[model samples]
Every structure is written in structure tokens, then in C-alpha cells.
Target: MRRLKWVSIVAVGLLISLSGCKIVKNPDPDSAGQADANLTDEARMAALARDIWDTDVLPTVAEHLVPIDDLRVSLAQNEQAAGQSHGLRPEGEANPWNFAVSGSGSIVEANTTSRAAKLQVDTTGDGAADVTVQLGPVIRGTAIRDAMPFLIFTDFRDQIEFAKLAGGLNAMAHERLSLPEGDIIGRTVSFEGVFTYRDLASAPEVVPTALSFEAPE
Candidate 1:
């Protein structure tokens, strides 16, 4: 009789636990951390850019930085294989593969005259740029926007709004980038940047999230 009573109590406790559980059907991880719906479009764009750059971009790159040399070698073999190994392209995305890369190299060229200012980095020590990093009042390409796997195209109202978000992110990059006040020519600089390349043949055009120069020696 005592054993039966104990079993009944255990059964009751199990039933209570089951009653408290709620099943979430088809939960989307990306949607869980989306921008505030109440925010204005302009404000939402800015917020998304900050969230992508500061919260997602930096930490994700820091954890999975691909070396320049390895990238070139892998990319030569095959684009799909290279992307899977060293970078990311959203599932079923026909877009260029986006990569997070870090390397120290000399700035062979600086085009500060143009509003779309850029530094040509020679990471291979060969006198030519292995990659071009945009430091911009006008940054080109959708590298930052593309790097964000969470910001799905369908999430935005339309394609035009998506383009605006890209523009906002470029503006954010320009605002954050700090270059040496003096001549930056031939300066040894280290950077953590993101770039997307459609073709395997052309050099990467990167958008840096973290860039710093080594003090002149």
C-alpha cells in the first residue's frame, strides 16, 4: 500500500512537469534576434548595421580568420570547396562567397583622393596587391551585407530596402575606420576584413571591420 502511494506521487509529479512544457514548432534562430519592429526604417537599418558589425561580424571573424595564403591555394582548387572550408555563402545563395580574412601586409597603394578610398595590400610580399581593402566615405560591394548570414533577403520589405541597408552598413564602416593621420604609404598594417568574390581569378576587394597600423620603426 505504501509503495503504491509513492508510485502515485511520482506519477503526479511527472504529469505536472509535462503540463508546464510548451512545444515551439519550427523555431527560427535568426528571427529570435531580429531588430525591433517598432523602430523606424532608418533607425532599423542603422541598428541592423551595428548589430551585424559589432555583435556578429567581429566575433565570428575573430573565431574563424582565414590566412591569405591558404585562401588563395584553396580557391585555386575549386570555389565551392574553398567557400565551404574558409568562408560562407548562405544556403542556396547564388551570390559570391564571403570570406573573413586576417593578415599583416604593406599598403602598396592608397587612393585617399577618391571618395571611395582604398588601400592595396601586398600580403604575398610580391609588390602587388593580393587584396584591396576599402576605407570609405563610399565603400563598394555588398561584403558586409553578404557576410551577414542572418540577414535574409526575404526579411526586408523589398530589394530596395535591402540595398538601403547595404548603404547604411557602408556608411557605418566609413564612420568607424581610423587611418594614420600622415602618409599611409608602405605602412605595415594588420586587418580583419570581409570580402566577397564572384570569380576565382580576380583579387578580393575587402571591407575591414578591424584595422590597425604598426607604429613606424
Candidate 2:
């Protein structure tokens, strides 16, 4: 935990310093090639959001969620290339193929019962909140299995509770949750992250808009 805190501070300093430079963050991957006149640091942040979503978040999700029949998933744009590698030849060669890249990682869950639905989002890979996650709670019953559902964000402290969950290993795996307030306190959630080379390649699509900025209260 101490190490994570230091990392967050270093990242913040770097971001602040970069804000003064000429380069700005780009929002869309497609827009990356185009040259802009002069964009502010805020614009750069938006651009950063876009690139992060496409390159990091989106692909990660797609690789995990997208399904493949064989133990090995092959990613290809056409069947002829896929057929050359794998025994099976896809009927429609135009469509892309999915091949196994690596074994799956741990699963993490994110969920909320808070009505506000806001969370402290911390990016920059520091493993700490640049701002804070004020999202609602996904409460579990006081007892184990059998319990009544309740609102998670009924109080302000729920923010701290929510952060504990979001900052967990699940968020590292790029998984978020939507759950009843009662269940957030105790319950295991599933999550995964993946990286693939193609656009249609089954992987998580980065939502730059969601991850673009530090959540400020």
C-alpha cells in the first residue's frame, strides 16, 4: 500500500509538468495522424483518454469477453491465412479469426448500489486514486448467502467502501461492476483483461470518455 501511494504521487507530478508542454492528449485513435494547430493541456488529456481507451481498455476487454472454440485462438483478417495455420478453414474468409494468445488471468468484479453512480477514477498506473471513487456501494448482507437488498450509497462513507473495491485487483484486470448495495460488502466478482491486434478482434474496447480524466469531487 505504501509503495502504491508513492507511485501515485510521482504520476501526478509528471502529469502536471507535461501540462505545460505543447503536445496535447488525443481523444480518438483515428484522429492521431492529423496535425492540429495548438491544443491546450486539457485537450491533450482528452486525447490521452482516447488513445488509452482504444489501445489499453478496449482491446483488453475484447480479448477476454470474445469467445473462441479451440484452446488456441488465432486472430486473422481472412480465412485463407487462418486456414494455413489452423486445420479449420472458415467459410467466410473475409471475416477475421481469433487464435489463443495466452492463458486467462485473475477475475475481479466491480458493482455499485450508490445512487450517485460516481467513482474516484485514478489513472496513470499508480494503483492509487488520483482523485477518488465516490461510486455507490455494492453491499452484501450482514449474513452470508441469505440477505436483503439495500442501497449502497445511502451515506457518504460508501465512497471509501467503494474505493476499496475499485482499487482492488479487479480494476487492474479492467472489470467494473453493477450490483445491489447489499452485495458490495462481501462477494467475489469476476473480471479479466486482454490485448489483441485487430479492431474487430474480440477484446475490450477502451471507453476513453470514462477513463480520460481524474474523478474530482
Find the 10 residues in a row with the least total lDDT in model 1: 27-36
lDDT of 2 by residue, 1-217 (tens): 9999999999999999998889767566446345342554334434443445445544543443433222223434553444355322123445333231222221122224354333322232344322222232322111100010121234324554433422232232223333333423222222222211234332322111122221222
User: Which ranges in model 2 have alpha carbons more than 4 Å from their true place?
Assistant: 1-38, 51-56, 60-179, 193-217
lDDT of 2 at 80: 45
TM-score of 1: 0.76
| Angstrom error at residue 60, model 1 | 2.3
lDDT score for candidate 1 against the true structure: 0.81
How many pairs of residues in model 2 come into backbone collision?
43
lDDT score for candidate 2 against the true structure: 0.32
lDDT of each: 0.81, 0.32
Task: Specify the highest-lDDT model's number.
Answer: 1
Each candidate's TM vs. the true structure? 0.76, 0.21
Number of the predicted model whose TM-score against the real structure is largest: 1
**RMSD in Å for model 1:** 12.2
